[model samples]
Target chain A: MCRTGPSPDPPEGGETTSTDAAFTALLEDSADELYESAPCGYLSTLMDGTIAKINTTLLTWLGRSREEVVGRMRFTDLLTVGGKIYHDTHFAPLLSMQGSVSGIALDIKKAEGGRLPVLLSSVTKNDSTGRPQLIRTTVFDASDRRAYERELLRERQVAEAARTQAEEDRERLQEALAVLQQSLLPAALPPVPGMEAASHYHTASPDRLGGDFYDLFPLDGKRWAFFLGDVCGKGPQAAAVTSLTRYTLRAAALHDPDPVAALTTLNTVLHERYAAGDPRYCTAIFGVLEQAGDTVKVELASGGHPPALVMRQDGSAEYLPTPGGLLVGILPSAPFTATTTELAAGDTLLLYTDGLTEARIGEERELFGDVALRDFAADLTHTAPHEVIEAMTGLLNSFGDGLDDDTALLALGVPTDRPDTGSDSPT
Target chain B: MDIVSRNNVTVTGPQDAPVLLLAHGFGCDQNMWRLVAPALAENYRVIQFDYVGSGRSDLSAWDATRYATLDGYAQDVVEICEALDLREVSFVGHSVSSMVGVLAAAATPDRITSLIMIGPSPCYVDSPGYRGGFSAEDIDELLESLDSNYLGWSATMAPVIMGNPDRPELGEELTNSFCATDPAIARVFARATFLSDSRDDLKTVNVPTLVLECSQDVIAPREVGAYVHDVIPGSRLVTLDATGHCPQLSAPEATLAALTEFIGNQS
Candidate 1:
């Protein structure tokens, strides 16, 4: 340290220089000890954003020389375009208003033109008269913070993309499952000349591909055959059984149109294929559609499936007379029973998968059972094919997401004598 | 009455490849550019639209008489530009749409920025001097095949469509996409599309041009693209390293890089 007066003895320590050694040591140590090893970057800025003073810590962090930043650049010049906007809009305003702001975060654009994120707290210094002197600030390196935020954003984007892809995959699977379930049944119901028929396969789960199927196909000269069945179990194994049942039933019907004989043949075939310990079986009702002028005959046979519901034109409803039949394919050649009923004009025959009657609605977990379905059928007997479908579909929809299986439906009815015969089916 | 739809136009980008108006080819709507549009969006205000009788555009606006000639499609391009208040447009055209762009560019030379054609051809017939690859007899056979076979699924084009799709069943979606077309009208459109000669008007395209040629394309030959390139003055030809009739489908990244560099350089 140099002073205007003559050199003095070093603070009475014998081996001396003529100065205050303590003050000299403090001045010398300030540059290397405090500036280089300071907690953060230190700088002084002019009121108009020019840089006046900077420390070695900041200089080293920015990879620049002392001459390059101080006097040559302003604090705003050190900011990137975005950083500058933040400085002008928020930092400068808040600092000017308060006369001092601290712990603020900003990026000091490096001399290399790349971004250098920093936490910069600043204060306006005062002169003796309390007039504003210069702006003083300390900058903490925020590279890790910026990188972390960028990674967080990238991760969020990837998660969002993955979520979208999963949703698409799930939707595609549902559509595929729907189409597979549909293919197990007929493409569309065969039009009968003298009767109305409606069928619904209530699904318990959308995710699980169920093993229930229904179809109304034209049989020979004046007959149409329809059937509804529930294959045992769930998932892919059940799907396979459903596929086998569909093809075998069609083949059996072609061999012999008699309902009992068709059921017997299917029983024997299933028994032969899956009589092992890991055996499988299903319940079914097959019927031959017969036209008798204004009346139709449904000679149906049962193999442990639910009985057909007969809703008369007179608004009367009853279960068809089907009794004493075992489940097909469970036993080796199980016996099936046949029953016949006459369906007069405006009469409807309801056929459905077991999911409709087996659904659990109340707190007791009691089955929905046959009575509710019968009542539902009684109300919808006079409605057209579409109305019947809509009513039944509404009932199933009321079940909500509770119905977890796949569903298939087919509806047919003899048209009423109106000028417009082409009334499209109901929603 | 010519029955065609006139909706589904979207404008997005830098507001700056100037305005590049794009028209899709036959049998598809504007959704064909889903993969490549985002890249072009960075530099150019690219416009994409659906032509009636295809895609999700309104079919009710189709008028048979007005749409009978190529001039009607040209008028639609001009009308859309005027409606959106677009000027100095860079028009991009695909197969059937290339000729439509040519006709539109000719009508309003001042409004066009450039013409960028992807998979363009003048005619489908085998002339005395020129070979468009398909003969008149071949095109007829193709049309007949379309009547019988196009109704079912085409595996390549299936996923590209976001709307009704034809699968192995050939029922509902088939009726919507292929069966919706009147066989007679489609046949007429096909004939008009394949038989037209637009080489005479190529020289008259005075705007700055860019021809994006897809390599190994069966529909639009490289030679044909070169022939068109020679006719248009001061036009830059960029041959993309890709195969198939659709570059936006087969190679999106390469197409994006090229368009970005070219548009940036030009700007």
Candidate 2:
């Protein structure tokens, strides 16, 4: 164990004499010497901020002599103009109330032109009676820390600007997609003289373009041409196929007016246009409507598509099946099955894309197949064409997130014998 | 919105006495008048309020576009006067709020009858023949200083700075809430305070105005105070024997004496 008291006299030796001299030198380094040359600056001021005492370290940092600073200057006189305002407005008031303030950053002016960044702390020194007498302060150099903080602040500003720019670009792109989507469908369907007609289209996502399409336009004096179809795939490629199919059917119907002839012309056009490395196809129902007296005759042909449904005025609904039809745009010579139906007063015919039957429902992911849709139609057998389309639109909305594909619906019916109203006029 | 709660307004002293509307400057809130308000309340009814972005006011009402200029702050003063239904009031403002007083008085001439400015400067940056004691570069350096000090304002200090009026005990817990404000709001208020030039507006002041200046101040020098007195047609100037920019805190007795004497003469 080390001795705490005075050690016994050692024998005279060279090593012992050198150790004694080193100890004497360390003991001679007085408290006053340590204070004047300390690493950080130290200062003492009167309660009103008159500089009463300052160490050599702080005097040297200010680039001033002890005589010039000690009695003549105040603490605020050593700060920059901005630091003076901040001191008067914030620091001095806070110290007066809090008794001590720590980790406050400020800038002090030197005798020369430059400034020195510093971190300062001060505490009030009270007399024996517990009344405040003076203030003791300590300061440290913070040049490196301030520089690093400035770098971080700059980087954050740059990142914020980039994020705002990205948001603006995304909004502009979505607007352009919406305008292009509107051009792929008709604005309104023309009104048939002795019939009622309605249509609805649903899009699954705004980011991608939908492939389903439908339109109805007058073909001649007493006949109208209509078609509904869904192209394979989605986006711009499927949109191009849909556009080609619509125009081909409309032009072929005006020339011949046969439902099978219009589908044959569309199949030829789609097969030739997309026959290279990438193949495209579609499922379509093309039909023609002819008004004869108070009744209308409907003839439609299907190309690998679902059959059309006919709801009769006798409160019954059935499918007009067009079986054995081959997929359009696949084979050079494809067969399309033609089916005929008559719509009396209060009877409606509906055509829809497969997006309705293939929709996934509930947590079980079950398909709302063709059977449920037929039963749904049977309840509305005596309704008008617009009423049937409105009910189907409501059913589509009820699916919510379960329906993930684009859908199109088209309905046509002969008007009842009641007095004609101008509400159905094509204005 | 209830204007009384939105501005954290406090009314004190005799209700039948003449009104004294006190407005604080840029750095602090209405608490800047803490040292001198009690003495003034003995003679006059004192009305104190904080701007939307300062003190315990509703910070949610602060809009970046509306608070971008000095006119927005002037609108706040006008709204407070209208809310209280005050008439023939003496408007006392400090620092940048001195110029804000000029605007509010010009907007509602009948309501605000007189103006008293402490450490007021119509402009901060120097112009052709005028010396406002600062340059454009100096203002930029001040903004940097504000940014550096904001780094020291930690999360633990947020609750103390954002006072809770619901619990009166929490208000007592705040000892250092004088100059502590949200840094983002402080930046906007700082830019609006320092970058404005209201020298042209000073000529339009037709009220009984008093300009108070400190004997030795680094922020607003004696020359700027003299310029304000010269521009106004009939204005009285008083030089307080003080050292800093804020005379209310440094030399409260002299500030209150000069204020009481001028207000007494006005009546």
Best by DockQ: 2
Superposition TM-score, candidate 2 onto the true structure: 0.77
- Which is the leading candidate under TM-score? 2
When just chain B is superposed on the true chain B, each candidate scores a TM-score of: 0.81, 0.95
> Tens digit of lDDT per residue, candidate 1, span A200-292?
666666687788888777778898888888888888888888888888888889889999888888888888888776688989999887887
Clashing pairs in 2: none
What's model 1's lDDT at A420?
41
List the global CA lDDT of all models. Answer: 0.69, 0.85
lDDT of 2 by residue, B167-233 (tens): 7685555555666677778788888888899999998999999999998877889999999999988
TM-score of each: 0.51, 0.77
Query: Which whole-number lDDT from 0 to 100 does residue A69 have in model 2?
Result: 91
Q: Report the Cα lDDT for candidate 2.
A: 0.85
Stretches of candidate 2 above 4 Å error?
Answer: A1-35, A45-49, A88-100, A123-135, A182-270, A278-365, A368-400, A403-427, B1-22, B36-50, B55-61, B79-90, B151-184, B252-267
